[model samples]
Target: MEGLSEKLASKLHKYSVLPFEDMYGTVSPLDAFVFTNYIFFLIIAFVATLVFFVVAANKTALVPKGIGNLAETGVEFIRNLCVDSMGKEGVKFVPFIGTLFFFLLFANILGLIPGTLPATGTIGVTAAWAVMVFLLYNYIGIKKHGFIGYFKSFVPSGVREMGPLGKWGMGSFIFILEVLGHFLRPLTLAMRLFANTFAGGMILGIFGIFVVLGVKEISAIGLLSSGLSLVMLVIMYAFKLFVGVIQAYIFTLLTTAYIGGALHADEH
Candidate 1:
């Protein structure tokens, strides 16, 4: 075990771990020059997104040219998506949901750039987002319906309307399942994003290793493998971009569903 560990550590030590390890630290403990490590990508993502919105909003074009046009398109898509999923009440959540979508899109897309780590690649980052949405929806539900009412809405009135069938056994049974499903949404959200990004990052690192070995070894098979790896890397990165966009959309879609459910549990 020790020998294998040493050999593996010797060969794959650097590539085996997460990226952007040494980037996060404070210059001083005063919180003035505090340097954040993993959050660096998040800050960059936020700045880039803010700049985009500012440019898009400040456009002077009458017919929505350039950034303004793109912004308008994005708004239309999100608005339609939210409304279709949540009805008119979704209008209130467009800004929030749109911001969520944009932030995630930027974060995921930024990771594709060489040497940059995505915040969403980490479970902590994804969980933070999931938890925020989960809490926000729950709070909205409780605020609108009160605590008991909000929880009570988990099980249908029909389940309890059948007298003994509802009250004797089925009501409690369905309520437990309903509670589990509601709470499990956040976990599923976090794991889906985190696992996809982390796996992609690790695969890229593995390809880097293969490419280096192939180039350094000076053999026909090694050269061929290296070339194949490079080609595969390009394809994988392109797919990663698609995955990022889809994941962002999925996350926002689920967020809207949760919010819509919380706001009108009876209708759900």
Candidate 2:
């Protein structure tokens, strides 16, 4: 079991962010600053996403087909999510939200390839996305309502209705809690996506190790175990695909909800 664990760990390390010299045995002055597995795959995912949408756009017509239909369906899905979560005002955010959704979806799917790592599996990547979202919604809020008004919205209406002393005391307390929760949003978003993607990859790698170990044993028990491990690997691969799609949707959904809340904070 320990040996199996060690093997799995070594396999998983290949997917981690490492310097170009360490990962690819190449030496360059810029390697330490800009070259890493994470950045390499991220650029691949980004370029792939850009090319897909561009191609889809060119293929657009009154009656869509093939990739055009797939692209339109994806657009409609994001459009509906935004509109449902943010109402008519959400229309303006469709492009940004759609880009986020497709980029994440492509990244997650790309990782399923035997040698690639999902960028979202890294905390740094997910954190960058979460921070971008945090800044965007907060900026929208402050733009819609002045800076003071935007901050003031953190206090509940009931707090304002209390007696003078109670209003100040309770309002201050609730305001602090709200501010803390607001700041924690990015942390939670980053951790959720990172944990799910990283853990899923780990599980897949473990089962893969089991299959390899079983194949090497060569006895009756070995064959049985190898067969079982292969089955589990197939099951896990399918499950990972579903999880990839779900995590992408969940991230996008939460982003839309956060933006919507900021856009309509006065409604609360």
Pick the lDDT winner.
2
Looking at model 1, residue 201 earns an lDDT score of: 73
Clash totals for all models, in order?
A: 1, 0
> Where is model 1 more than 4 Å wrong at Cα?
1-36, 60-62
In order, candidate lDDTs are 0.79, 0.87
Off by over 4 Å in 2: 24-32
TM-score of each: 0.86, 0.93
Best by TM-score: 2
* RMSD of candidates 1 onward, in order: 4.3, 2.6
**Alpha carbon lDDT of residue 228, candidate 1?**
92
Candidate 1 per-residue lDDT over residues 41-116, each given as its tens digit: 8889999999998888898377778889999899889998889877888888889999999999999999888877
Q: Kindly list the per-residue Cα lDDT of model 2 for residues 1-268, writing each as its tens digit.
A: 4377679768777656676456755334345465777777888899999999999999999999999999999999899999998999888899999999999999999989887888788887899999999999999999998898888888877778889998999989999999999999999999999998888998888888888888888888877988998999999999999999999999999999999988887776
